[model samples]
Target: MAAIHLPRTIRIGGGVLDELPEVLAAAGLSRPLIVTDAWMQSSGLLARVEALLGGAGIAARAFTGVVPDPTVTSIDAGCAVLAEGEHDCVIGLGGGSPIDSAKMIAVRRDRTIPELKAPHQEDSPGLPIIAIPTTAGTGSEATRFTVITDAETDEKMLCAGLAYLPLIALVDYELTLSKPPRLTADTGIDSLVHAVEAYVSKRANPFADSMALSAMRLIWPNLPRACADPQDRSARAALMLGALQAGIAFSNSSVALVHGMSRPIGAHFHVSHGLSNAMLMPAITQWSAPAALPRYAQCARAMGLADDSEADQSAVGALVEALHRINADLAVPSPRAYGIERERWEALIPLMAQQALGSGSPANNPRLAEAGEIEALYRQVWH
Candidate 1:
């Protein structure tokens, strides 16, 4: 039997962010430590949230030390802040990095970072997390996963289980309305990869399949629109909802090769998680589609890139081409083009492959690859 998990409460819409006090009261939580990035603080959103809480007679402290591709060091820093407060819950109030930092911070209990890595599931709950996602990507709000990089080793640790999942998600499309075009494109593509990878994952079940298909339908069309015009409320709303669905989808079914391989790129190259995923998508899709033609074709049809009349083979081909075209249209750069020195990239291929294998995500692919094959894929993606 397939297992399923989700947040206890999810509030979605425009201006739902204003109901944070009510949500806190409903959960019987008074004090919260808001986990966010420097941008959120500088943009004055942190102050606005604090004011809202203060107006409701609740004083909240915020930790704004989160960074992109959150590291073990950052998590420790946030946890140190968590220790200084009587905070009963955590408010994750930014993109994936802050939310992930919040999740890791809540669960850390003097345990070493290596102890939490994949193959060791952390099912026990930690401090309640109230996720207020400011972007339409990563789906960290709806997920049971957190990715943190080991700064020294350059390994992106994939930590799993129920503890990483949020207790509540406040999905406000309004929060994403002001996102710039590049961030919009990268995160949008990241959500699409979540749906695609989950749909084809070996762990996929009926429940996850439903969510993945629905996410593809919403995301595939709206992504471009949202990227082209950030002010398009409908597109932004659709993308936000689509990202949540994709998060739920992958959370249940898991992500495969694209995610496994992409993490290493993020760790070594310092690329944003979503942008790294975008760079790897086209090549990986072309590589993996052959082993799951019918499944890939279904994804194509769901994304409106193909129709029922088309054969699976042709549909899969169309899907690969569309992925490449989307990357081109979105201006996603190859690792080489993104300016990773060729010698450094070649030198790390073996270690990156080893790290990718250790992540355990590649095993979920329909067609698994050995270290050598993964090394080759890394080579193929350089240009």
Candidate 2:
């Protein structure tokens, strides 16, 4: 059996964020550091949390410097703010970027980015993290991994292990009610990719398959609804749970080529994580489906794109067509439309491929891609 791991506590529902105070008190976590981005701080969500914590007689301070594609310097700045406080725990409040930054800061408060990147057994535990996700993607809240970009090298480091896992995750769909159409679409697709990849990963096991299939069932139906109308509370809740389910699925089974290749784009072009994953998904699925026809067919069935009686080949083709249609419907831009210049993208293909390979994620891919193959695929997607 593959070792199963998850957050110690997971509270999932529409009004779940309202239970934060009771959750914190039960865990005996007071004087915590709230990790988030500038947009979150400015949006009054931070103040709302602070008021809630203060009302509970818990002292907290906000570290709102986390940027998209969280960097080593940003983690360092967060650590500095953490060091200034007598914080007992860390609250990762916002999207994946902030949650990931909090995880790095929790485990590497006293170490450098290079040291943090290196794999090692953690003897002492990092500070307990209570994660609250505002976005329906990244699954950082349930995973044992955190991706932090190197400030000097522009490489996104996939730091993993128990040290990065959160103690608790609060899943509140209400937080996602205000997400813009673009964000809703991107994150929703990201969740779909996670479930699909997890189910097809080389590390796939029965436990992971269960979660992945369930995630696909939840997300595939509601993703477009949530994107079309952000105020659709039922759709929001379904997508939120779907993202959480996929997060748990990928955390244990691991994300493969789509994520392996996606990280480099985020590190280099600063594309949002979900969008990059979306852009790579169709191409990579086409390349890898032959390697796992039955698995991809099951995925198509799980997404309700194909019935269970369909032949594997037909299902696989439907899967690819569905992905393309989803991208088009979501208004997802191609790399050209996304503003990545042809010359610069071509120049960086080799480097991006190298970085993607270095992350070790592609090894979990059903169709493991060589650096040359990855480069060619990267080249293909540039249009």
Candidate 3:
């Protein structure tokens, strides 16, 4: 039997951010340490969360030290803040970085950073986390995983298990209305990758399949609209729901090669997670479709790129083309175009490939690759 895990509570829709006090009360949490980034603080979203808490006689504090691809040093700082307060819960208020920071900070109690890395399942509960996602990508609100970076080594550590899962998710599509086209594109593509990878992963289960397919259906159609017009509430709502579903899908079934390979690019070159995924997606999917033809075909169908009568091989081809088209249309730059030095990228391929394998995600791919093959794929995508 397949196992499933989810947040204890999830609230979705427009203006759901206003329900924080009631949600906190329901979870028996009063004082919260809001974990967020400087952007959130400057944008006044952090204050809004604090105001919501204040409305219910609940006092809250905030740590706005989060950075893109959250680093262990940042988490340590957040942990220090958490220690200073009697925060019954941690409210993660921003995108994936802040939410991930909140998750890590809540559980970091006395352990060293390396102690929380994958292959070490942190099943024991930490301070409860209430995730408030402003972006429709990363789906950090619904996932049981978090990625933190080691600034010294530039390795993105994928931490897993129940402790990282949020107790509640406040998903308000309205929060995404202010997002610019680039952020919207990258995050939207990130969600799409989550769904696509989860659906094709060897760990796929019926529960995850259902969510993944639904997410694909929603995301593939709505992403462009959301990017073109941030005020498109219907598109925003669809994308928000799709991202949540994709997060749940990947969290349960796991992400495969795209994610495994994407992390190192993010860590080493400081590429955003989703854009890295986009850079590798078309090439990797083309390479992998042969091993899981029917599965890839189904993904094409789910995205409405193919129909029932289409041959699996043909549909898989279409899926690859669609991925490339999506990237081109969204202006996703390749490693070379994005300004990563070619010599450095080539030199790091072996190390990045090794790190990808170490992540345990490539093993979940329908077709497994050794370090050599992964390095070749990296080289292929460089242009």
Candidate 2 lDDT, tens digit per residue, 50-101?
9998998877888999998899889889999999888889999999999998
State every prediction's TM-score relative to the real structure.
0.99, 0.98, 0.99
Candidate 2: count the clashes. 0
**C-alpha lDDT of all candidate models, in order:** 0.93, 0.90, 0.94
Query: What is the C-alpha lDDT profile of model 1 across 1-383, one tens digit per residue?
Result: 69999999999999999999999999999999999999999998999999999999999998999999999989989999999989899999999999999999988778877899999899998899999999899999999999889999999999998999999999999999889999999899999999999999999999999999999999999998988899999999999999999999999999999999999999998998888999888888888888898999999999998999999999988988998998898899999889899999999999999999999999999888999999999999889
Q: Where's the lowest-lDDT run of ten residues in candidate 2?
A: 115-124
Worst 10 residues of 1 by lDDT: 105-114
Ordering by lDDT: 3, 1, 2
Candidate 3 lDDT, 1-383, residue by residue in tens? 69999999999999999998998888888889999999998988888888877889988998999998999999999999999888888989899999999999998889987888997899899999999998899999999999999999999999999999999999999999999999999999999999999999999999999999999999999999988998999999999999999999999999999999999999999999999999999999999989999999999999999999999999998999999999999999999999999999989999999999999999999999999999999999999
Residue 75 deviation, candidate 2, in Å?
A: 0.8
Better of 2 and 3 by TM-score: 3
